[model samples]
Target: MGELKLSTKIGYGMGDLAGNLLFQMTVIYLLFFYTDVLGISAMAAGIIFLIARLWDAVNDPVMGLLMDRTRSKHGKARVYLLYGSLPLGLATIAMFYAPDLPMGGKVAYAAGTYILWGMLFTLVNIPYSSLTASLTDIPQERTDLSSIRMIFMLIGVIIVSVATEPLVSSFATPSRGYFSVTAIFSLLALFFFLLCFRLTGKAASESRKKDESYKLGEIWPLLLKNRQLLIVTAASLIGNMAVFIRETSAIYYVTYNMGDSGMLPFFLGIVVLSMLAANLMIPLATKKWDKKGTYLIGSAIGVAGSVIFHFIPYDQTALIFLFGALSSFGIAAISTVGWAMIPDTIEYGELVTGKRAEGISYAVYSFSQKLATAVAGITVASVLQWSGYAANIPVQSDQTLRGILSTLTVIPVIFIVLSMGIIRLYAIDRTTYEGILLKLKEKMS
Candidate 1:
């Protein structure tokens, strides 16, 4: 591969920008929409989230295998970006569409659209992620690319965070507001996907051709043997719990616990801005410390912030924002370094297994992320349900507020600690990665 132009970096970043626009919206608001807007119970909404993501357990890898087998002029991964973009956009719109229906009908509708959206998302996301490995073999370049991608992703998050509530409130009803904003976002997502396809062109397919010799049945063993992949996957699964839990619980914390709905945007905005600032520092951090060391630093920061937020009273708004920003800064580091680590693991897998299975590697990683999302959803909902949370209530009970606070703070801290422990076992430093790349080149020669 040649040096990546600045345009190529921005083009690659655009795909994530599009993805986060819809995905961040879901992470932040889907449960709230299902319960408060659609009148579903918290537990039921949680079940919907669980089932939809569990279905991805099957759906994501299938798309991975499909992408691995695809032989198209558009490239193994970019082909999906070209063909899957519009349908994914449509599914995004449908996911937010609230139909007038009975409770059962509402659950059924939510389940169907969400599952469909998840499926299409896999179609695009697995390939999009796989492209990281396909685009470049250089470790430093991959790190740089991942940083640029996170910057765009945070931009998308900031847009959704600051804009969504106001957009929804501007309409006649919350339902209409959500629907309209999603529709507009979906269109914007479509355009960005196309731009990504155009700008990224074809991925390097030489290794992919060699990958064709492996059976689909071999994917499991390959991933299992690639110890780095499993470590990162476990770390991602646990780390995402912290992220999703905070995101899903933020609205409730602001509205019910803090007693101010208007603060939602400012609260989320600070988090996103903190993440953006943290992202800008990732390259510097990675330069000063190895990825693992950088990741551990992030975990420590996140845990500290979570602890501070847990002790601070809800009325102390400035303190809350300051601590939340600290936590989000840590999350940004964890997420950015984690993503850059994946492409390195792809080469590691190739060195161990003698096959490059970027699609399946990323697929399994994506599956773990979705699994984390499912668990976070159910965990948040179940706690709320058990705490006697009621939708549309002017004020929640002390128990319910406690449950919300725990979900936002303490539960996330536990997972962040676990993720740090898992990541500690990762042994792939720069020296090991370089050795793996050298061995792969020798094997190819």
Candidate 2:
């Protein structure tokens, strides 16, 4: 396969930039928004998250199968990108909108909108992710694509982390502010998705012509037998869990443990910028130590940072940012490498089964991500409630503060460690992948 044009790579990256604008906002603030702004109990909000993600267990695979079978002038995956972008943007706006209703009504509304958002997100994201394999088969280009995607993803994260609060505060009410900011983001997301659709037209058509279709029932056996896919999926899940746990609990940590809610944007900015810095290092790091080795190194760095962050005194705000950035930097490597690794698995699976199911492969991977988000949401909410958290409070009990600190620091370290162990079982190094690709090409010819 030939190298993709720089324009095409960047246009592809824009899809993720669009995705993270809404996604990071939800990861960082939605729970806070539910408990603090909307007056829903933490437990209730957590349950809503769980319910929505559980539905994705079914939704993700179905969408994947649909994409695998789709035939269109626009191509299988890109068709969804063209059509689903607008609905997805609208769903994001709905997710942030605060309805005026009783607690029951509020929970119901949150659940309904959130579920709708997740479904739409799956509709677009599964196809978008699957598009990577369709774009190229070269490992270096895949890594480049993942790196560019992460850079854009982090930029979106920075925008949400740094700007959301100020934007919210600019409005008469927090609710109105969230709604308006989300609307602006939604419009921007729409434009970017469309741009991506336009720029990647050639690659999408190529992917459709080359891809082999498989039956729906084949998904399970293919998934069950693909050991590399299973390992990477598990690792990705745990890594995402660590990320979302820290992200979800960060506001509480800044608000109660540090006694300064105002510094959230600054704190989050430091973390994301550090992640971006790490993302920039990925191509270099992969050269030094292939993807698996690079991933382990990054996880170790994250573990060290998390441990240090846990032990530091809350009053040492500078130290907090320092270690937090360290952890985030490591996390960026894990995320970028993990994504690049997934596309390689498509060929690996095909070599084993004589089948190529990019949509199902990415769908299962996407479902793991959603599951991680759900688990993080519920875990944080339940922990907070158990710690005697009460919203809109000037002060929290020592136990509550400690709970917040642990969720932000210690718990994530545990998840990251587990992810490190899981990834060790993934046997697809550069040599193995190259061999697999060679065999796949032989079989196809």
In order, the Cα lDDT scores of the candidates are 0.88, 0.90
Q: State the lDDT of candidate 1 residue by residue for 307-327, as single tens digits.
A: 999989989999999999999
What TM-score do all the candidates reach, one by one?
Answer: 0.98, 0.98
Q: What is the lDDT of residue 386 in candidate 2?
A: 94
Q: What digit string (tens of lDDT, one per residue) describes model 2 on residues 1-445? A: 5689888999999999988888887899999999988899999999999899889988999899999888888888889889999999999999888889998999999999999999999999999888789999888889989999999999899899998999999999999999999999889889988888888888767652555577777789999888899999999899989998999999999988889989999999999999999988998889899899999999999988888899999899999999999998888777899899999888888888877888889999999988998899999998999999999897999999988988978888889999999999988878999899788778878
